[model samples]
Target: MNPLFAFDDAQCRSLAEAHGTPCFAYSGAVAEAQFRALREVLPSRVRLAYAVKANPHPKLLAHFASLGASFDCASIGELERVETLGLPPGRTFFAGPGKREAELRKALALGVRVQAEGFEDLARLEALAAGALAVNLRVHPAFDIDEGNRIIGGSGPSAFGVDEEDVPELLRRAASLRHVRIRGLHVFAASNQRDASKLIAIHGAVLDLAKRLHEAHGLVFEQIDLGGGLGVPYAPEESPLDLAALGRGLSGLLARHAWFTGELILEPGRFLAGPCGVYLARVMRIKESRGTRFAILEGGINHLIRPLLTGEPFPVKAVGRGEGTIPYTLAGPLCTSLDRLGEVALPDLRVGDLLAFGTTGAYGLNEGMTHFLSHPVPPEAWVD
Candidate 1:
């Protein structure tokens, strides 16, 4: 079986028969394998925090928690999901550009570290904290970010963190806050990047930025979060990230930066979850409009929206069908013409043919427009 697809034809058929069409199925074995693959290669000082935004499935959360994984949460719902694990403090981190006071309070109550985006976050956290609090300042670096998709909004104007140029002034203003202290630095400058060397270059730049901040402001960091962007192959032609190379680069960085003794943090979401899921939907009908042949599935963007957002479709195959030279434009059952999965080559597909989409464990259903058109939401099965 291709690593891109979590299940073989037999497993896909079985899952479709058990869960019905237009549903999702995740393999716990595959998810754990991915986590272990990355974890084994990482340095001892590197903390692996599974980004909860990827897939907050309770079973998935519990599985990762059992492996002693930390969690990276961005919303109250994610925090709540992680809370159900009842893990000890310092195993969770809360981060967002616009965190509400209620969310901050919840984070504090649960002993979650806050990734402060700017002075507003610091001020809000200070107001909410009864005693002293420490946070990691999220800075939007001025360096060029090499991302194929503009998911993080690049190095230009962004709504995510404090701009690199404005950090000095923000730090000056934050000095007066009595209850909140910036004890760490956070910089997320990559997205879905696969090259280990490129990711290392980006991480090195972030560390250099941290060193400059420390030298200039006399700040001491307990942690430096190199935010998530660790990528996974969406298609077979694309290669998976080089875990060994990534580990070596990080270890080298730690050795070089002896002045900073804090542990490095990697919040990986897609790389850890993408390969374990398979979205199975049967073809509703076939349409040959103009020169294009469309295989309209029972579900569309409502269930899987990453194709529309990233212009990159998840790897898919017609279950029980052999390979062919025939081309197909995969479409969903949505009302709009924009509801497309992707254009691909597959065996001759017919109505009721089951199509299994691979690499959807992360940013699959949860990121879709579930409330659109009143379509029935697809059920997700956890295959243990």
Candidate 2:
């Protein structure tokens, strides 16, 4: 099997035949390999928590859990999904901006660490907890963030976390809380970034911010979570993130910031899960309009919406057909004109020809409009 596709032509054809087209198939081997690859390079002080929002497949979650992985859950549903794993306390975390009281209760019941988004969370947790409780403060920093991507929303006015400048006041208010205590700092300001240096720089900025808070407020952090932004290549031309360099840089950061003896956490969802899965869809028909060759697929944004949302297509290959220069505008079966996956070069595509999209294991099915158009949701086959 080619690393790009996760499955070879024969395997892809077999998966398509077994599960039917317009479906997702994940390789547990790929998932483990990705985890081991990243984990082996990271510093021992760095903790790896798999972000459950990437792909919440039960098998996927359990598989990561089996590898001694912690989970970063974003919603009550995700918390429930991680709950099914029966992990020990401190192995799971709940994070989101709008957390319901029930959700906070669930987190409390599960003994999962909560990444509180703002003062509301602190107040809510204070009311919910029976005794002293520790949580991480998810901060929206105002400096040195990658502003190009859509996921993290960069340093601009964002809804994800508490603003950095306002954290002091929030902390002042939080000190009056009876139970909830801030023990960690979380900063997620980048998304799908490939450069190791850039990621390290952002992380460095976060540490600097932590240092400022610790000095000014006499705050002590038990953990500094560098939230999930580690990237995986979406294209053949793109280079995978250099994990070795990343580990070295983090090790250096930890050594330099000796005053902060707390653990550093990396919650990577896409970086860990994206390369382990593939989406298989068949060409329903080919239409040639004025200037474009359209290959309409049985699935599109309804199954995989990253290309439509990010304008970046997954690396695709026409199984059983060799590569060619014919450009194809890959569109889904949706009625809207906006249901385009991507326009890429491929061999002559025919009806029933299977198109395999690689690096789709994470955000593929989980982030799509599967219920739209009343199309039958495709089955996701987990190949262990």
Candidate 3:
């Protein structure tokens, strides 16, 4: 835990009392700190585009914008948020697999940088740009980016990028399109990877490809967009991310690409905002049977949604009128057994006590539901 509750104990308690159970609390300081740490590591040559899908709430986006960070949008709605926040199109990069033509048209109109996933997207973008937009090629690298098949792509097959063998033809096609400028290249491997070595390997591959492309086509890439899958420590014993290593690796790669003419781009989502927020749920019931204890929280898969769906483990801490330490099974009040957050060892959990779950910041709120008996949703509080 980042001592999230330590910052504003009274306010957190008040918010819980007023807003009822199943609320969210986010720390502005943590968010800003993460960005600052990233700035320290990111090469001076690259432009940082914070991926908005991690936490798209307007206030958070505005905070990132104020820090001079750019935006990476996945959909038209996200693009509109960028525009509405008053961030210029040049500062935002539009990237998503299977983007609709409407979204591409919006991106083109906004004059933002775009990433084309395949040959067809290139065709669609060229047609839509009508002589006005440029895009990077999103390449699916040859690696086991994901440990399992849960994510968008992995080793065997993926639908998110052009094949390595097809690069020349894709470039040839881009060369023909007068309106669409092929400005760069991109590779997004996976999310929540703990080992920094894996990231280094992945970036090494990206740079190797860039070097080959430069040699073959007389193409000097202005920008190399590396999609972010930076993971935050969700387990209590895990160490914080080694961003310094990532920075050194990335900087070295860009240094080798002296032929590249434009800025370097990084689209990081989880690293920027995932650990900044904590989910607060009220214990509705506590039961023990056959040497097992369960602290059933008021909210289920409906409010804090990702755990049940992805099996990603998050840490849970007992708060508000609890003892020092105890082992208990933490579960949501939902009927489905899988609605359980996980088996957690917390300090003396009791009915009606508040339980704070760590690292719920990335996918928790946005992926939550209002389904199953239509339980009222909780309020979100921003903390300093």
Candidate 4:
């Protein structure tokens, strides 16, 4: 696994000093590079919509907007953020299983395309719309999904989209709606998947599902949304997603499914935002008990809870300490025992030692339980 840190040791050290400890610094250059790297490889028929749920920092949003990237927003606040970009209609999308009436109204007012979760969304949208409305139906496929992450619940049962088997009934009911029309198919069946072949397989399955809907119900889709599951490396031994393979696979998919001339949309939240961040904190203390070593830091789940939630730690490096083989269990200053980051090998540490966590630009401070112990919310510094 290549290091995902946006800055090197010297840069990390300088950022920590300048921003203070327990703060996050995001690299604007890295963010732009990531977007360009993914967007440039995609075919002209495919659209890249950055998932705002990943990291909603205004600077990040503005940067992506400047790069001609559309947005996939999930809530009223997110929609408000994208609204600030003043993007034209269709550049912003609203998708969530539990969208409030206010959010739907907001989306409608902003002229955003919505990925309706179920009949409720369709009915509500119809009730709210003044005229005709088009939406992409989010389907929860019955087929197995290979994802093993907590972010997307596995194939068993999900609260997302309508179930695949019920689509016929849904279409039947949707036919009666006066204003709402299902113009697209949205299937999100994978999570944090790195293998392009696997992602392609899942995407192929989604297209096949769309075909079934089209053939059976005469549904003509204007868009086929293969929801984002593009993975990024979290560990040194792990490999990043193969962009070339993914691009080629998608292009080939398009070629094979020539019956569908509609555009393809990918809502990538992490793949586009994960590598541009570094979370800086100082070692508050070191303790050894019961033969276990602990390097307790100034922050933990309070500011970065992914480790506790996913059991995978963001890559960390001790600033300016070079490298060492000593293993240390990282603990946060939280009062709960669940407030741990991860166990990793780093140089010998002491009080005031600075630690830098990489690949946290996606789910770092934003997803953290910031008010749990009342630690001041970490400042987010956008480094140009």
Model 2 gets an lDDT of 0.91
Q: Which residue pairs overlap in candidate 4's backbone?
A: 1-236
Q: Compared to the true structure, candidate 2 yields what TM-score?
A: 0.98
In order, what lDDT does every prediction score?
0.93, 0.91, 0.77, 0.91
List the candidates' TM-scores in order: 0.99, 0.98, 0.91, 0.98
Worst ten-residue run, lDDT, model 2? 144-153
Instruction: Please identify model 1 stretches exceeding 4 Å from their true place.
Output: none
For model 4, how does the per-residue alpha-carbon lDDT over 1-384 read when each residue is reduced to its tens digit? Answer: 235899898888888878888999999999999999998889999999999988999999999999999999999999999999999999999999999999999999999999999999999999999999999999999885668875888677889999988888988999999999999999888888999999999999999999988899998999999988899999878998999999999999999998999999999999888999999999999999899999999999999999988888999989888788999999999998898999999988989999999999998888999999898988889998
Candidate 2 vs 3: which has more lDDT = 2
Model 2: how far residue 234 lies from native, Å: 1.0
Per-residue lDDT, model 4, residue 164, is: 89
Candidate 1, position 303, lDDT: 92
User: What lDDT tens digits, residue by residue, belong to model 3 across residues 251-323?
Assistant: 7776776766677787788788887887788888889979988888888777777777777656666665543
Show where candidate 3 strays beyond 4 Å: 1-11, 144-152, 289-291, 321-326
Q: Who is ahead in TM-score, 1 or 3?
A: 1
The number of clashing residue pairs in model 4 is 1
